[model samples]
Target: MNKKVAIIGGGIVGASAAYYLSTLPGGDQINVTLYDDGVGQATSAAAGIISPWLSKRRNQQWYQLAKDGATTLMTLARRANLSTDVYHQTGTIVTRTNEKDLHDLYVLAQERREDAPDMGEIKQLDEQQVKQRMPFLTRSQPGIFISGGARVDGAALVEKLLAQAQQVNLIVKRERVKLDDHGKVITSMGPQRFDQVIIAAGPWINELLKPMGINVDVRPQKGQLLELSIPDFPNQENMPVMMPEGERDIIPFGQGKLIVGATHDDEGQFDLSITPEATQDLMTSAQAFVDSLSADNIIRSKVGTRAYTSDFAPFFGRLQSHPHLLVASGLGASGLTTGPLIGRLLAGTLIYGGTPDWSNYEKPLSTYLS
Candidate 1:
């Protein structure tokens, strides 16, 4: 019997899951339909960093999850037929403001190196080396450079995933969805019955699930970004991603556009407004690293609402309340990094009918269901 699968939310997670299910063997038996409203999604506005080694997280489980997320980027790029430039292997320089912070980062790089040798040539960079590598950078602090660090154009990635999924006969719908009784889904187009429903919606998960009396601990985390045009910056092609001193990061998107972001604000709503305070804060910190950036360099600014969870871990698995309903969300900032792996794991679970090892990171939404 064919299993009709409804994927609610057309962001990275949902799109990737639909792509995997449409392409994988035995997936032909699973009819997949992906619905998306394209409003307030995180993937489009993500900084798209894939270097998990830069993170200070000590939890081995979390590290492994992030590692897998980083590892799967190449495979996803290949599947999407995207070039390396599009999936960007520009590498990343993880630095700090003070000696203490640099020492902490050094220790973390050392500790995680053995487990993630795929990160490629983890080396400590001195001030001169940092400046030479990142010509736009003005900070003189030493940092750790992961040669394998990469970034992706999130909007492009989503477009490719949706396009590829459609090539394999996956239905794509642009509409909001709601759950009806008897485990069926109702979209603006119409109501449809599916054997399985995966909610990979970003911050809007609750909007669809609430009417059905289902709730998860996922909420919207707004991150604002500033795009600066530096057409004259030297070494534009080879400039490494700069993470200097604080939470602010600079990702050069080539063609003289640099993405400086971001601010994590938990305002508890779908607010995409870019505030003057956030713009000033991001611009001030960004200029501290890239000496060339000025107020005039500012081209544009945008905001994305990420799906944040109480535990900082994404939930992915079947809900106890609705056996047919599955969830893959709450990825926070790592959604673009771990999206492919999430899709692969969820598709495998639905098709093969086993937990399969990686599902350990996929907590059941029922745990936080209200």
Candidate 2:
């Protein structure tokens, strides 16, 4: 008996779920139909930094989720045979505006390493060492280095996931979908029924589940990014991601492509327009570090809507009232870090029928949905 599964939102989570369902053992028994509107999807404009160990946030649950998510990402990269251009362990360099805060961060990373050693070597680098490691960096600040950190191209990764999933009869429709109270997926083509439905629609989850008389604690957050290309730059493809003391972090990709400034605009709503203000702000901040953010070097700008909760904790699992319905959102800025694991967990639970570990979460599903 083939189980028909319909996944709404073809971003990170949905694509990942489809990828695992198509590649894992016994995956042949499940069929997947994914719907993606492709407007303001957060993953498309993500800041793709996977160095969660250096975060100063006190939420242990979120920290664990992010840590595990980084692990899951590598596993999928290997299984899907993703190219170096899409994913790479370039490590991460974090800087602080205050020296004491930077030292505290180092101590925190060291302590965390005792329990979770996968963060790799943790060390401090002087200004000279920082510039030596990343020569393009002009304004070198004291920084800490984490060897296991990685970077990814979010859009490229999703494309690869969908491409691989399609090989196993995965149906992809570039349309929006809704859910009725009776448990059917409402599409423009017509009403469709599925044994299971997973909604990973980022900030748009409320709209998709509205007709079902259910609501989740999710809101839109617009993230703006600036992209630039430096032709013939030295080892630009291999430079580690940089996290300065602000919203703007520099991420380098293959072929001298550099990304900067992922602004967290909580009031920006679902608007996807790339504004000059954002572009200028990103470029100005980046200019302090690199040689140029000039008009000639500018490639483009991207904006995407992210999901967030009031307390900023993400929740996932089968609905208490509707067990066949699964939902995950409220990832906020950590979407790129946590989305893949949530997708893998959703697929595993749907197939293997086990309770996801909720001991780490303070409120679990009740925090976002009851």
Best by TM-score: 2
* Cα lDDT computed for each candidate against the true fold: 0.78, 0.84
Residue-level lDDT tens digits of model 2 in 271-360? 888877778888887888876558788888889999999988888888878888888899888877898988988888888776777657
Candidate 1 lDDT, 1-370, residue by residue in tens: 7788888887788878888898889988877888877888888777677788867655555667778878877777766688655687888888866777777787878787887876887888889898888776666568889888887778788887888778775898887778765557887767787888888887787777777777678878888889888865765766788777765878887678788887888873578888988898898888687676778998888788998778787767776667777777788888888788887788878888854554346544555567
TM-score of 1: 0.93
Q: lDDT winner among the candidates?
A: 2
Q: Count of backbone clashes for each model?
A: 0, 0
Clashing pairs in 1: none
